[model samples]
Target: MTKTILITGSTDGIGKLAALKLAEAGHQVYVHGRNADKLTSVIAEVKAVATGAAVDNIGGFVADFSDLNAVRKMAAEVNEKLPKLDVLINNAGINTTASVMTKDGLDVRFVVNYLAPRELTNALLPLLKKSSEARIVNLSSAAQDPISYKAFVGQERLDDKDAYAQSKLALTMWSMDLADTVAADDINVIAVNPGSLLNTKMVDEAYGEYWASADKGANILTELAISDEFANDSGKYFDNDIKDGAHGDARGEFGQPHADALDKEAITELERQTQTVLQSLSA
Candidate 1:
């Protein structure tokens, strides 16, 4: 059966590839990007690969994840337009930016990589709950560091690497917390490190080189989003960098994330700090 899937940042990188693959497989795919023109183009590209009824079921949304207000607005749009959402892939992230801080006194990396996805997922919970089996696949990274609340709130400035790492750890931590919080609702939340330094724009800009093909990442994401293998997997981290010893393929493997992600104290504090920041944003 074809499922309704929404993938953020689908105009580029592994997200774009995954969106195209899913569409070709006949799933209803909604692609999102920060730029309207790019989103429109990607929607057309994705539709070109679609089979069956999925050709006419393509959708698109434009939202700059650095701004919480924009994320909320996009979520509202998704809620209003879609009846039920089966899968949500939070794939938008930034490593380097011209401006390190947003106008709202939050670090751009943390806002786009962590906070925005959290807000979007929470806002779409009602629609997700409507599906028989809803899955939230968060794009996390292997390069994780301990989260600094001060840096997250824009009080302490960090270099690009520190900010990006901490933001990913924050995302992984929340994925676990959210999974437990919504377990009764049967919505599975899984955080995944979609292979480090894949040949994508982000990696090309950050490292000037990539160790693997972006398809390696896209393949795992497509599986995590729709394959029955992950139907019962929730609150777990999938490390695609780990090769299957038996098959020698870089694919999905359940693995431990940052040590902080496993700490109950850290998760609770992150939850508290996130709520404080969100409330401040709303005010």
Candidate 2:
């Protein structure tokens, strides 16, 4: 069964590698990014390495996840195009040195790293449910261990640089919580800390022109995506830092237990709060 796998931010790094790897495994992969030019190159690379895979046209989507309006439009369009999705990889995120504000009046890190993934996953829930076993993989980080307050939504009034880590923490929390909610439906929502890849362009953007790649980091992501054994593993974090198992620190102590504690009341409150905010903003 060649399932349809949708990966966000596949223009580079772990996401890009995941796309290529899944394609090689004969899955229909849809690669997404904010820039068409970047996505064009990604599609080319994926096709080159796809071996004997049963891939589709290699979808190229351009929507900056930082923008709410853009996210809504993307959800609508992607929903229409894909009636059923087997996997949804929430891999698009950013680590910026300076804080920026999106059009929706939310912190850019919160929007890109956290809110966008939440919005997109919510919008695609219906399509995901259509499939027998759906997997939603989120790209989380061990850096989210402490789950800092500075990076939390609106903690800093749009100037704090640590928002990146904070937002990642939020995403990890959400992934765990969502997993428990959808587990009964057989929809596995898991997050993995793809470890630290060496020499990737993302490092160059944040650090400098030179940084050593995590010799084994490149292959860690693919393991989670393509491994049949891990196919049913849900609500767990992959510590790319660890070779055999998920890094215990990726979600910190609050991750799994926290998600386990999310009752119907909590989920309803969260949904209401988020929907109110989104509707207010859109209005």
Candidate 3:
């Protein structure tokens, strides 16, 4: 069907591998990267494997996720690049050892890992709404710690902040609530835990155990992106490409056991806080 797919952070690691695999699967892949040279080479790799299909249909957008302004610009570009986006993968994120803040004064890790994707998705929601069937895949991890913006603004935690993990938790919860809100519109949002340890730069430079090859890391991502099973399932978490109770989906649950992600009350409060932060950024 040559479905159109856009993946952030497609320059390297799991993201780039996902782009390549989707390109090979006959999907038009829009690859993004912060680096121009990396984006250029990734485009070539995608084209080479995209034979028998309209190779030039692939597209690229470059933006450093670290900067909020750059993120806003990227958001605008995405709205203009594709008219009807079939899938949007919020895969671009980073983890830092120390606390840093964006120009808008949000923690660097929180902004890049969560705020960046959130802002981008909201900016493109109109175009996404235009699609008869649209899916938004957000990358989440087990170590992610649930957080409250109420606990962190102004007094924002940065020093050796576990803010990276907390940011991810916030993102997963946000996806959950958003999924429910948009389900009626025929759009689905799902959060994914790619895998446990992979030999990606994140692990190589930081934790030292990202041993899973990019191919393996990318599978769950593409599966959820193209799979039809998502119609019955939205706002759920999948680990290592498995449905609940499959293989490694069983990570110790967080928050309330009954509903581990984010519930209505928490989501409402978080959304209010998020709006306040976003508005503060603009003001």
Candidate 4:
């Protein structure tokens, strides 16, 4: 059956590729981009590549995720447009060259990678509940670092790598907590480390090298979004780089999440800090 899917940061890279894959499969695909021009172009591109029957179902939304208010507005627009959403892929993230802090005085990485997706998912929860089954796929990474609350709040400075890693960990922690909170609703929430150093714009800008195709990430995302294998997998992390072997064994088949992601203490702290930040944003 065709599903209704929304993928954020989908103008390029794995997000865009995943959007194309879903659209081609005749799913109603909603792609988002920060730039209006680029979003329009991507919608056209997806339509161009989509099967003729699927072309009409492709759409786009524009939002600058760096701003929490913008994210809220975008969520409102999405709720207004889509009656029910089957899957939500939180794919927008950054290792920035611009200012590391947003206008609201939060770290850009934290806001875009964690806070925005958190808020968006909350805003759209009602719509998600309308579906018989719903999936939330959060993009995580292999580079997670312990989150420093001060750094997350923009009070302490951190290098790009430090900031990015911490933000991803924050996201993964929240994913687990959210999964538990919504389990009774029949919603599945999974965090994904979409293959370390895959050939994507973010990887090239940060590391200048890549180990695998962006499709490797996109493939897992597509699977998690719709495949039955993941139907019962909630509040778990899928480390795509470790297929079916030991953690940190980069050659292993990717399946389970890293050890840190499963830490009870870290997960609790992450939830506490995330709630604090969200409250501050709302206030």
Alpha-carbon runs more than 4 Å astray in model 3 = 97-99, 148-151, 159-161, 241-260
RMSD of each: 1.8, 4.4, 3.4, 2.6
Please give, for residues 1-283, the per-residue lDDT of candidate 4 as tens digits: 7788999999999999999998887788999999999999999988987775667788988899999889999999999998999999999999855788888788899999999999999999999999999999999988888888999877898999999998998888788889999999999999988888888898899989877878888888899899998899898888787753222324323355545577888888777877788788779
lDDT of 3 by residue, 147-265 (tens): 74643464656443377677777888788988888888888888887765665786565676543555656877888788776655677776653333323332322122114365678
lDDT of 2 by residue, 220-271 (tens): 5555555676776887766655533442223212133234123455445445
lDDT of 1 by residue, 30-75 (tens): 9999999999999999999999899989999999998888999999
Candidate 4 lowest-lDDT run of ten: 244-253
Regions of candidate 4 where Cα sits further than 4 Å from its true position:
244-260
Model 1 CA lDDT for position 206: 86
Better of 2 and 4 by TM-score: 4
Top of the candidates by lDDT: 1
Candidate 4 shows a clash count of 6
What's the ranking of the predictions by lDDT, best on top?
1, 4, 3, 2
lDDT of each: 0.93, 0.70, 0.76, 0.86
Measured on C-alpha atoms, candidate 1 has an lDDT of 0.93
Sort order, TM-score high to low: 1, 4, 3, 2
lDDT of 3 at 45: 90
Residue pairs clashing in model 4 are 242-253, 242-254, 243-252, 243-253, 243-254, 244-253
Identify the leading candidate in terms of TM-score: 1
* Model 3 TM-score, all chains together: 0.88
Candidate 2, superposed: residue stretches over 4 Å from native: 53-56, 97-99, 145-155, 158-161, 209-218, 243-276
